[model samples]
Target chain A: MATEEAAGGLAFHPMDQFLVRPLFGGTEIHWYTPTNVTLWMGLTVLAIVFVLVIGSRGRAIVPSRMQSVAELTFGMVHKMLEDITGKDGLKYFPYVMTLFCFIVFANFLGLLPTAFATTSHIAVTAVLAVMVFLGVTILGFVKNGAHFLGLFWVSSAPLALRPVLAVIEIISYFVRPVSHSIRLAGNVMAGHAVIKVFAGFAALAAIAPVSILAITAMYGLEVLVALIQAYVFTILTCVYLKDALHPGH
Target chain B: MATTTQEAAGHAADAANAMLPGTDAHGSAVGMPQLVFETFPNQIFWLLVTLVVIYFVLSRIALPRIGGVLADRAGKISNDIATAEELKLKAKEAEASYLRALADAKAEAGRIIAAARAEIQADLDAATARADAEIAAKTAESEVRINEIRAGALEAVNVVARDTAAEIVAAFGARADAGAIEAAVAARVKG
Candidate 1:
């Protein structure tokens, strides 16, 4: 509640943007609270339906503008999963597509003025990453049995160093979810926080022009980050699916 | 804001900040709202719901339709290309058949012309032979007629000469027989 800057008349509350307040005017935030998270996530769903379902209602061989966009997203995610995991992985195309559309739509929608980024939350991204991690791990085990653990074992390494290499690989495998989740949340949060900081500086007319320029530049970078982070997340998910489908090396 | 409203801005900041998991009594964020552990449950629950909803929507509806559209486009393009190729083959066949018909017609025309020329030459030869035969016959008849007239004229002249000789002998007071006069005239003529 006490920002040192706020007491010093700086009045910069950048982190305030991410607060989880109830949508129906209440201070309490229960697990089922219809908060801004709900609002934005709902909007993300509507946007997806609008583009993917209603946009392609024409089912035109020559697609409309929105249909083209819908097809582009669908094709990109579909190809990424298929390329990484091959044909057998196509069964999980919808799941991968779900992750991609959720993150991408959430990221883009968050860029709007006064929009709360659901993807920017660690809790949200962590859940998504952990779901992919658990699902792939389970799938690997189911498909390959005990051989799934061989993903950590370096078969090419010398026998003496193989165990150590396995240890390293194991650590890296566990770190995937942490890094994956944090990377998306961190990138989004940093860009937004920096923009907020710049906005705070804009109240001072002397450096308002500089602050505005910085915000504009940061906005451009944030937009790029938003799209790139979604791509990164989807690609990583596909990569993990690859490991699950073929848990050899 | 100026220095006077420093405390007031913090109060305003409190108005925006939900005094939830990571906020102090003054109602500003303790650290990052993203790190607050208490709200994780809400965010996670919502995220799960969203993911499930998206999965059903995509798997059930969107993906199949989009895939169908792509498949349909590909099929249509290939089908159209196949049709075009068939049409091209048909055109080529038609052109080849047309050329063959033209060549056949030309050959037939050439044959008819040759036959007509041969027939015309034969008719001309027959007409020329008939005219030559007719001219040969007419010339032979004219020669015979001329020979007959010469003989008749020669006889008349001889008779007149004999009469003239007899009249001259009588006028000279020396009578002469017609036989003698005739014999003399004949002998002089023979000499």
Candidate 2:
């Protein structure tokens, strides 16, 4: 495979698209610097506004196509929150819904040729996951107080093994944020990278058709992955929030 | 071996530097930029902003509108169902009343027919009674006339017989009184 890659001559820089360069062609990246991430993230926000705000502006009793789409997304996320966390968990619905919409929009927008996938970066996903983690933790303490720690303790287990189980449980509990962020970022990054690799292979005349076919198939799968990842992320947030609301076994 | 490991570490550093933007060292740009520490703050800041914006838009505007439409549709459906039920009940009552009125009309028509038949029968009975009375009167008058005619025929016969008896006595040349002959004829006819 290494020889084949070398023989292919074209060094496919699949990860270069993820580079955070300044939008105006500068090299240095600062906290406030306008970069490709800023542009795509801004575009994601605009796309969300277009769908949620302008799409449902008519508020038609019988929805138009755009209105239906907006309503479908709203209802789907609403139902997910309600089902996973119950009605009590609905207080955090806006946060979870925002996460879902942003992730979904960023993912789908990334599918556009040459568009940046903001959610594909660990920085963005980590921020989202950490915020969820912090919010749920704070809410747990605020709502449940000292009893929230009972989530790590397994009273159902034997007394001798309870402490051992607690340690493992605590580790897993803390690992939630890491897994949450990486799952989304990894899935998005992998799909985009795979497509890029296939596209790079398409430059070869002998394997161009096969590479294009693979790209098309991967793109289709990536579309589903993009939506599902958003769903999985939101549901996980709901689960964490549920734990905070009722932090027992 | 130590020198070789140090050389590898220097090569790795060179590769990392080469991957960084604006570095002169050359390497394949295969590194994931997501690990780049310099861009973390920027991505996090924008993510926070975007999430906050999306949350506000959804909670304040989008969700409410969608909820309103769903609620309005549900309400409309329930109201239409209620109205349909009311109308169905009204239609049932109308049908019942219609049947009741039809029954009443039929009963009234039967009464009218019966009354008309009774009245016609009464008229027929009266006319028959009047015609019988007229026929009985005519029969009585005819009976009286028949008796009178029979009495007149009997008187004529008696007169003829008395006259014939007187003529025969005169022709025979016998000494007989007129009063006595008359008496004899009367006696014979009476007997």
TM-score of chain B of each: 0.61, 0.64
Record all residue pairs in model 1 with backbone atoms less than 3 Å apart, i.e. clashing. A1-B28
lDDT of each: 0.87, 0.83
For residues A107-164, write the lDDT of model 1, one tens digit per residue.
9999999999898899999999999999999999999999988898889899999999
Best by TM-score: 1
TM-score of each: 0.84, 0.82
How much does each candidate deviate from the true structure in C-alpha RMSD?
Answer: 6.8, 6.2
Runs of candidate 1 exceeding 4 Å displacement: A6-8, B1-18, B133-191
* Kept native contacts, fraction for each prediction: 0.79, 0.70
Colliding pairs, model 2: none
DockQ of 1: 0.38
Candidate 2 lDDT at B141 equals: 88
Cα lDDT tens digits for candidate 2, A1-249:
211244657557677677776788645555677888889988998999999889988878788899899889988988988987789998777778789899999999999989889999998998899989999999999999999999999989999999999999999999999999999999999999899889888888999999999999999999999999999999899899889998877
User: Positional deviation of B72 in candidate 1, in angstroms?
Assistant: 1.6
